[model samples]
Target chain A: MTHPPLRSEAAELHLSHQPAPEDLERPGRRQLSPADAALMEQKVRKVEVAISLVLRVGVLVSVLVIAVGLGLMFAHHRAYLPLQGDFSYRQLTSGTTPFPHSMASLARALARGDGRGVVVLGVLVLILTPVLRVAVGVVSFLYEHDLPMALVTLYVLAVLVGSFLLAGV
Target chain B: MTPIDFVVSLALVSVAAGVLGSLVGLGGGVVIVPVLTLLYHVDIRLAIGASIVSVIATSSGAAAAYVRERMTNLRAGMFLEVATTTGAVSGAYLTTVLPTQALFVLFGVVLAYSSFATFRRRHTDQPLTVSNDRIANYFDLHGSYYDPAEKREISYKVVGTRPGLALMYVAGLVSALLGIGSGALKVPAMDSAMHLPMKVSSATSNFMIGVTAAASAGVYFIRGQIDPIIAAPVAAGVLLGATFGARILGRVASTTVRLVFVVVLVVISLEMLQKGIFP
Candidate 1:
């Protein structure tokens, strides 16, 4: 894709006379080589890709875990099967529905090979996905040498973790 | 109902909720809560718990592609998370200690207002050329995204930073207290207050809602509100539906999307007001 030399040269002359307004509007506007622009775009794109991958993987894993748990539950609990009118299902979702809520109880349920415990673990994974995204943002910002943003992201992470800890207790 | 019948029916309904929620950045709680409580006859607390977990699934699942395509202004989302996460944590705590009937009425009124505001400005696709907001500038909240529907790159500057952040705090609080993504509030804040393009606003809101929901998800879990039996199917269905919806977002017209969002807001507000007044 070669532009005619004379046309390109004339275009350059026109650009020299009237620079692109978008260039002037950019913060810290200055001359930047095409290579530099590409490099910066590449860097920004890398960060986007990384964040995207984290989210995709998190979702994939959580959904799979949940599906597996559902499978296990149906396999083990024949009484709660959909064949007949089962009060067990109703009781499990009712006002006094008894299930593990705390970590210690959850761990005990899991040790007993309870599928509900595995499903809860999957839910925990879903809840933490966005927290992990914040952690990634911290690293991405630090990599770009953006101290302010890194600190902002770190603060968000701290608040999320703190809320979890404070709530768990 | 049998266990299989229960799970399958709930999952099917949740898939519809997820599609709508993912498209509007609303996290489908608007649909999940009502369907589970009103239609399924589940307890309200259990319904809310399932809805909150579904919100996390919807946001993260939809946000994956939005981030990849640069529709999400990650910087803007992160910056606002500072305010939203704080608000959410407090809101989670307050849910146990405070009475919320009045708050529900107030939130409904606010949503009605936001719906009107969003409708009034539905046609402004052009981004602000100049923003004097020092905070937005300092944080580089400005960004550009490629719009496949328009087939062009759109660059935009952010304005009204202070007001946007304030609205987001309220959004977070509402979400935590009500088990919603609160995108009904967030899209308006970004569209009218911050003057971002509609698609960017929607995507960024979607990106932000997950963190906001995650902030309070642990609290709900500890309170025994998050029943794994109810939540597991909802989460899986929402994620699947959200993945499909995310593919359609970039191809849809922004104004059409905004209109759909405004409709959701109006309906939800009316429902909220009805519950507050009657209950």
Candidate 2:
């Protein structure tokens, strides 16, 4: 069955029509009005370039974040290795023994001097990542005139607030 | 086993569990609990605590990308969370008071049922539309996404809002009590009952599970169940696996993934039953 082309008359929307197979094989052939063809070509090129940039940036950022988080964790683990005592996993689970004087133990001991700050930092990081993600989504929605996404962002903000109050965070 | 040996062994098991769980989409708790109880002989309560923390780590890592993509229904997630949070707190309390063996048997049954549900074929021929719901209308709970396969925009509404939210409460409670990530229940409630598309339901479920885990994780931390050595490896492994899984989700074949998930759950359920009855 042949399907009709989708058209919206609610607004004068410019959409690029797909080239027929015959036209596609013949590289320079054009079957559209000059103005329409020019507009389509321009719009297509712009979107292609924009999408390429977005993908590149996204990959770069993801790699950088993963690398940094891994680096920090590894460095901390290495520093603690030397101080570790004859601590065995069995003793840890049994709960009758104290942890050996390892670097992790030292870090925990130091943190105990200022445990509140570490907890607060952990909570802040937890809260901020989601907020940043939602902010980016909201901006994208506003650009696209997508009210639903904006509303979702607002709802998330509300939830965060409610959770904070309820949990007394 | 000594404390050091226990921590090291638990870490190794957690890493294996995380890798397997990510592959199957059930999360690591299913694997962790059995490994701890049957292999390492850790108390069930302590196993539950460690599993919950790992759940939070996995969910948090996965949710970041979903939120960025605008696929996660943040409103739907939060609104449903009101019910889930309440359920989680209640469930945590109940876990402390209830009989442990009974809870384990009940959890195994739920896992078996969920595994079957996941294997069922999905119906995607239905058009997206809003059902009559005052709450949904008031909240403007409607969204559309571009379906690449259909090459069209599909709009959908939030239906059966109240029932779906109520179900999430139960899901949360069960998750806390059983130490299983509740995504299995949350995804179905949103997808089938609330009329959300499957992809959106999955992403939103991923986002919400972290919050539920965190509520209980805090309590576990206070109770000193979070041994740093055990928690560190579990958290790191789960975070890595979840992030990898989320990245591949859009490219994977849906049916194949679901089938794998079902098989894994069936195995886990049988293991749980065997341990409960024999041990």
Candidate 3:
């Protein structure tokens, strides 16, 4: 008897149904028994939920920071005041955009409380969301005792960090 | 244009790009790059920098909802990411060494062919059930998702793990070299080579593209390519649009998704061809 895919199980991992006992015995197939598959799905679902939360929170925070920065720019920066027909950001696009693009410059700009600096910070946060999601994956995989996957996730994190360091160089 | 006019106008355009991108698994960079460079007359480098940020915003924003809905295959996405990130780093290094104009032409031809092939099979939504691949089974890369359009649960197994990784590596390399998320390549790699259902392939591609983009994004950032005044609105708008797009994906049929993706693929291929031939 097959079960209706329960709403509770709707978010479960890859394997959602049970393989017949004989199906598990099929050589080279590596089918997990129904109960074991359920357990694995449960664990995977936990990790997925965590990752979802991380993504949602990261994006929300970054968007909020950007909004605040935009507000600050309009409120304090005369150059950005609305409907100034004489003023155009066209000059900024012509290689004079006053914004931080590197860590050192970002740090300096933040110290000065520049609105562009705040916006850059938010951009950085957006870039880092995927990196943070990978970090969470590493921890969760380890907790699940999936060591090979834990190591795989760790390697990905290393590559991501290495890319950052090399880019700085 | 005035800063206010600039920000609001660009944000509105980015919202459209984000909705289309999130729905099709292509990131907003595809649309953002051309619009910024051609329409806004922004420098190509700064446009690329901003587009990279938009790609991440699309991925993370749409992925947040996709994962929660079980549309994204987490294990498959994570496993494929290893290959893509490595390829991205290597491609970044090779950028100074490779004749990218020729590569652009080559990939354009490849994409044109794929767009044709994808259109031919647009109506097939059947997910494969049997798989003998030890690597896929060992990694538990198989998955199932509830399709609201079909009103049924779809279960599928992954095959061709090694081939899928190879294709993803190439996709990542192209993305890094071109400064766009190559989800056009990624979706086919997953759907054709790995036999993931079309929706699964799209959602999983959405999940994976961010890491690939993020790898190159750091390099773009440090090179002073990213202009915050521009990138800020692009990111915010893409995120909002992606969130909205993710809601629509569940209700849309798989064939509709394929049709849309094919159309975008054709356009991108033509643009790529024009870039190579002209430049």
Candidate 4:
């Protein structure tokens, strides 16, 4: 549970004459020379930068997916017309006919003016978003060597599962 | 309920909700529910169900940016979620079984409380406390952020862990019963109690409220309360609105924004109280 004490040049200058905690450790902690400490900080910074880059990419991908999905939905809805297709306008409008229960039902509902289809699609997007968000979070935790947050992500999934089961939404 | 009519309405509502919800930081549920029930004459239960879906959309859209910036404390959010989800389930069940008048009364009271809380003075400059959590250290929960105002990297530890988490449980319960996003309470608990920075706490609260809503939304869905006709516009509106809000977050003076939010909350609270007392 011990962590390496974080030190910056300013902090180091303030303690130039004083011994570090590592100097007072029981087993005589291995002291990193100033050069080594600087190297370590550089490595941490590199890792941080790399992690940030990956997260940025992830955000972009998520946004793209959502945008495409919404676009397709809009296009399809606008193209749908009554009397041109076999399905009557009545069938399209009255969402309660319980049309074949499948993706077709969703599609038909959307065509028929059942706004619920849009909602279902919206929910799908919502679900995907958290997955992407947690993925990015996972990468960040990995870079930070934060196993607890990583584990907590798994726990979040469990909460998701429990919520699904208990709320049955 | 015709398909063509439904599609057009759904699209329009979705777009509106998305734009407005994004602007206000609410998933647009607050606005959507009233619109559906009062304007469209949809049932309240159905409107709530639709509103729930929109909450999910708003959170999902916004959570990623927050996560990437490391503004969301994943551990704190997940830990508090256990309480929220459980409470949400109970609240959902209560919503189904409670008398309409009683539910309205409770909802009104909660809305009023939330409105008052929103306008209250917020303490944002509190120093962070060191956490004694072995797991926190093992996981490197402590971190530093660049404070633009201070022009320094401020490092901090997560603290008041137990109390903060306990509060989330209550937050979840309220979220479920009321069907309102619980960010108002969750943000304060994390920032004021757990000692997270204001921005981080707000982002984390946003991340957590979705799961809370999902827990209850599922229940409503199963009960056949989720009329997609109603849900479609609500979700679409919220998603659009939340995204817009995220973009503008950094552009405005936060204090002014907060004051406006408080004023809105007060107005909404009074409306709810009037509805309950009169109805």
Candidate 2 lDDT for residue B71? 55
Give the range where candidate 4 chain A is weakest over 10 consecutive residues by summed lDDT: A1-10
Candidate 1 chain A lowest-lDDT run of ten: A1-10
User: Candidate 3: interface RMSD in Å?
Assistant: 8.1
Worst 10 residues of 1 chain B by lDDT: B123-132
Q: For all the predictions, what are the DockQ values?
A: 0.29, 0.06, 0.32, 0.16
Q: After superposing candidate 2, which stretches have Cα over 4 Å from the reference?
A: A1-87, A97-108, A111-169, B1-26, B39-43, B96-100, B123-127, B146-155, B268-279
**What are the per-residue Cα lDDT tens digits for candidate 3 across B1-279?**
798888999999999989998998989988999999998999888998998898899999999889988999988988999989998999999998888888778788778876876776676567767776667777778889999898988998877677677777888888888776779888877876677988888898898889889888889988888898889889999999998888888899899999999999999999888888998
**What is the TM-score of each predicted model, taking all chains together?**
0.91, 0.64, 0.92, 0.67
Evaluated at residue A133, the lDDT of candidate 4 is 47
Best by lDDT: 3
Order of candidates by DockQ, top first?
3, 1, 4, 2
Docking class of 2: incorrect
Which model scores highest in DockQ? 3
What's the CA error at residue A123 for candidate 2, in Å? 9.1
Chain A TM-scores, one per candidate? Answer: 0.76, 0.34, 0.78, 0.38
Model 2 chain B poorest ten-residue lDDT run: B121-130
Model 1, span A50-127: residue lDDT tens: 888998898889888888888888888886775567454677789798888999988998999899888988888888
lDDT at residue B186 of model 4 (Cα atoms): 67
C-alpha DockQ for predicted model 2: 0.06
Cα lDDT tens digits for candidate 2, B1-279? 444344455656666665555444456776777777678776666677668756655555665454454456655776677677677777767876876566556656656765655555343425345345556654546555544434566676666676576667767777767667777567656654566766666667776776666556545544555554455456655666666666555445445455666677678667656656665
Which tens-of-lDDT digit does each residue in B1-279 have in candidate 4? Answer: 344455467657666665545434455576667766776666676667667777776666565444454555556676667566666666666666755455555555554554454445353354354555443444444555554344466666665555555566666766676666666456555654555665556556667777677666556655555654344445545555565665554344435445555554565566556666787
